[model samples]
Every structure is written in C-alpha cells, then in structure tokens.
Target: MSETYHIPVLRDACLEGLNIRPDGTYVDVTFGGGGHSKALLERLDNKGRLYAFDQDAAAAEQAQKLATYPQFQFIQANFRYIGKFLRLHGVRQVDGILADLGVSSHQFDTAERGFSIRADAPLDMRMDTAAPLTAAEVLRTYSEAELHRILGMYGEVRNAKTLANALVRARQQAPIATVAQLKAVLEKHAPKHREFKYFAQVFQALRIVVNEEMGVLEEFLGQCASLIRPGGRLVVLSYHSLEDRPVKNLIQKGVLFGEPEKDVYGNFYKPFEALHRKPIEADETELAANPRARSAKLRVAVRTEDGVR
Candidate 1:
C-alpha cells in the first residue's frame, strides 16, 4: 500500500545520457515504477511523446496513477516485441531508447512476487503475470540436468550440479511451492559463510530463465540501431555481469552474434559508438541511498549509419 521503492537508478545520468529533446519522441523499454518514464515526460513539451513498455500489469497500473501527462503512452507488452508494438501505434523513429533491466525493488520487497530469496512467497517470478512458466513450475518440472545448466550459466553458481540434483530430489518428496522450500534445498549445497549471496544467485538464475531475459535483451538490442533515429542514443542500466557483458560487447562491437571480425583495411566496423569506454558505476551517494543501485552498471551508445553490413 505504501509507495514502492523503485528509486530509478542513475536518474540524472540516464536523462543526460539520452540527451532528451523538448519535442523529440522517446521510449522507456522497461517502465518499472514509471519513475524513468515520468521523469522523461516531465522534461518533454506538449508536442513530445514518450511510449513506455512494461509487461507487468502492476507496472501499467502504476503508470495510470501518475499525474496525467498528455505526451505519455504506456504499453503492456514485452520490449522484445517492441518493433511490433511500436508499429501498431504508427511510431517509426525515436530520439532515444532507455532500458533499466533486471528485477525491480517493488518486485523484491513484495513477498507475493517471490523475487527475493530473503522473503518466503510463492515461487512466481514472472514479470508479466500472464507468463505461463512460473518459478515453482520450473523447479517442479525441469530435469536435474536442465536445472544445473541454468544455475551454472545464468547464476554462475559454483556447485550447480549438486544444487540442481538436490532441488529435483527434494521437490519429489513434496512439490516446491514457496521460496523458503526451495532455499531449504539450496542451503545445504551453499557455502557456509557466503549463504545469502550464494542463494540470491540461485534465485536470480531461476528468475532470469522464467522471464527469458537473455533472449529478450538480445531482441531489444538487435532492434536498437534501426529503432532509434541516427545519432539518437541508447542508455542501458544492467545490474549483473550476465546482462552487462552482452551490452558491453554489443556497444563495442555492433553485432550480438559471435566474436568480432578483422578486415583487410583494419576498420572495426562497429554499429554503435560507445558514449563512454567504461561502464558508469553508482557513486557512494547513490549506493548509500539505495543499496540496489550498488550492482547497477550503465552503458550508453549512439547509433551509427556507417556499419550497414
């Protein structure tokens, strides 16, 4: 019932990074809490428009509660399908694109959402409630081998195999329904001193798979160069290495495919130009204010027309 603690990460930096124009069109790919979208709208003029997408129904409701802005339009859909969603509204070009990826504070603090390992709630980490695969279903249905791969590849858990085998074995005795039950299985496999961070990774890995985040990010970034008008900026705030690594690689080297290629002329031929060589880390001020921002890594890129290949 109280105000959610979304506290947009890199607020000033994101806005400045986008180089917001008074009458330009913009898109907030992840409109969690509508904090960034509202901020963007406030900076826009009557002619300006901001089209924000959030798959979560709760987030769309949050956007509805905001002070009415004529220039704001909220869409309830995944950003990966952004190309189709924007096209329906007859939108072709945007001045800037912003995405604040990963689970939000509201999702974590709210027990029913079951995102945080700290709380005991139903293992339903779907950002969009309509999403068919819930965390509980994943744990309850997945093979031990499949579970191990996700935990290892996504969460970077050290003993993923042990953890996966334990999950499947434990759930067989009783279906894993809540975060507490799942943690009980993972706790035995987790290290003694590093239990919290360790378990958090396990949960993070499950959440990422349930949401298909890596695939979603890939689709969203693939369209960015074409979506944004030339010279328009792309600002992203990724919370973990899994998310940041792709962003870093894409910004430095346009294509999200395999490794970069070398040419006879020695031209790198990257599609995007990095606004900053290094990722922007949260300052002590921001970290102290919101510990969630501690892991936030922001990368900005500008669209280039040169790399058509």
Candidate 2:
C-alpha cells in the first residue's frame, strides 16, 4: 500500500485497544489503505489470522499488497455484513475487531470520487462504487422533507429545513449534478463567514445518506456482540458523533438506542464492558502530524461473559 493512500490515525492507540494476541484471529472491518492491517500483520505470527474488508475498489487494490501474507485475507464488501462474510469463511467468532470509520484521505484527495468539498467533481460520494445511490441522485429524487431530515439528523445543519427548500427550488431550474452546482445553490443560504463549514456539513449529510452509513454502522455494531468471543475486544475509531453515539451506547448500555433491557434480577443485560470511561482522543503529537486525526475518537470494549448466547 502506498503511504499516501492513507496515514493511519492513532495507530498505536488502536493496536493497544485491540489488545492483540499473537496467534488469535482478528478482523479490520474498514481496511481502507491497509495501513492498520499491515501493522496488525506485523504483530501476528503465521498462526494469527486477519480478515479485512473494504467495499472500495481502490482499497481492494491496496489489499492486494498484503495478499502474499498467509495470515491475511481481504473481503471486498461492506462491513455491515461482517458477520455473514466471516461466517462464510468459517469464522464463527474472532478475538478482536477493529473498525476505523469515515472517509479515507485517499477518497477525499481523489477529487473524482466527490468526497471533498474543496473539489468541483461530479456529486458521486458512494463509498462502494458499485452502489446505485449517489449524492446527485439523492438531491434529485428525495422529497424536501426527506432532505431536511437527513441534513438535520446526519449533518446537524442548523438551517436544514431552509436549505432543503432551497435545494428543491434550485433543482427545478437545473439538475444539481456536480459539487460546483450544489455549492452554488448552498452559497445563497449559507451563513456568511461559515460557508465552508456549511458546505462540509451538507456534503457530509449527502455522503452518509448515499452510503447508508449510519444504518450500516448500526448493523455492524449489533453483530459485534455476537461475533466476538468472550473477552475479545471491539475497538472502533469514529470520526463524527453520528458514528460515535451508537458505539458509545452499545459499549455502555449494550443497546444502540434507548434504555438497556433488564433481566429478571433487575440487572441490565449488557454484552460488552467499556475499557475506558471516556473515549480516547488523539494526542497533540498525532494531531500535529495528521490534522484529520483531530476529530477521531477511539472507543474500546471487551465482550463480557454475561450475555453470551
């Protein structure tokens, strides 16, 4: 894998969170540039097995470099189906699972992928290139209310309703098929000095919806409790609150949303125990080295014996 493909954020911290065992089986669900997987292989002996997944074709190409390692295997699919894919390989349970969520640097840098607000490319932000939905399609087909909800919930955009109306109005005149066209529509509604941030928020919302990111994350998290062996680790590095909230809730409450279910004994039936009371943030050194790490939050949890089915 080319170093420029991605610089793994909080590399050491993530490895520590995984608490890797030399001969144990592991999975890196977001094998973006294989930076994390490569590092993981270095710590494992021949008996250690690592299964990595990525839907991006570019990432699959990077995974090819690690193909020579007998301990490493790459699956070209979304991590939402982690359990099913692992099961297909006869891996009923694993010792550790590491998820590094959000867009990779390579995606953003490659303007044609349309993940960056800085670029003026076709509004195609599907993480899995083969997926039917794209940012432009979402803008074209979604109802104003649907757009409003996604913007407000996913992007947390303050003027989501107003912006949604603007998009509806603008699209009537011309198709908002590219980043430049979308920005033109947004510029009129964006806060004066915060236009860039506003654009990012809008873009983020579109990307999330286009890729069904939150839904995918929820499914993957739900599977984690069952797919990991007791005492195994679940280490997730989430870039935004939308991604982090469910992870935090699952580790602390054992449910993605709302209150945890109670047993007959009146104790909550939680599957995992958090390793740290608070999620770990990038240190100043790492932040300095990779500005993208600024928003990264690392949370680690260990599967408990209590809820084993």
**Model 2 per-residue lDDT tens digits across residues 139-230:** 99999999999999999999999999999999999999999999999999899999998999999999999999999999999999889999
Least lDDT summed over 10 consecutive residues: which range in candidate 2?
A: 260-269
Best by lDDT: 2
- Write down the TM-score of every candidate: 0.95, 0.98
Candidate 1 lDDT, 1-309, residue by residue in tens: 123558888988999999999999999999888888888988999999999999998887788865488898889899999989889999988999999999888888888999988878999999999989999999989999999999999999999998888888898799999988988887788899999999889888999999999999998988887788888899999999989988888888776767778687766667788898798989999899888999999999988877643
lDDT of 1 at 96: 94
lDDT of 1 at 191: 92
Task: Tell me each candidate's RMSD, in Å, in order.
Answer: 1.8, 1.3
Model 2 residue 21 CA deviation in Å: 0.7
List candidate 1 stretches off by more than 4 Å. Answer: 1-5, 261-269
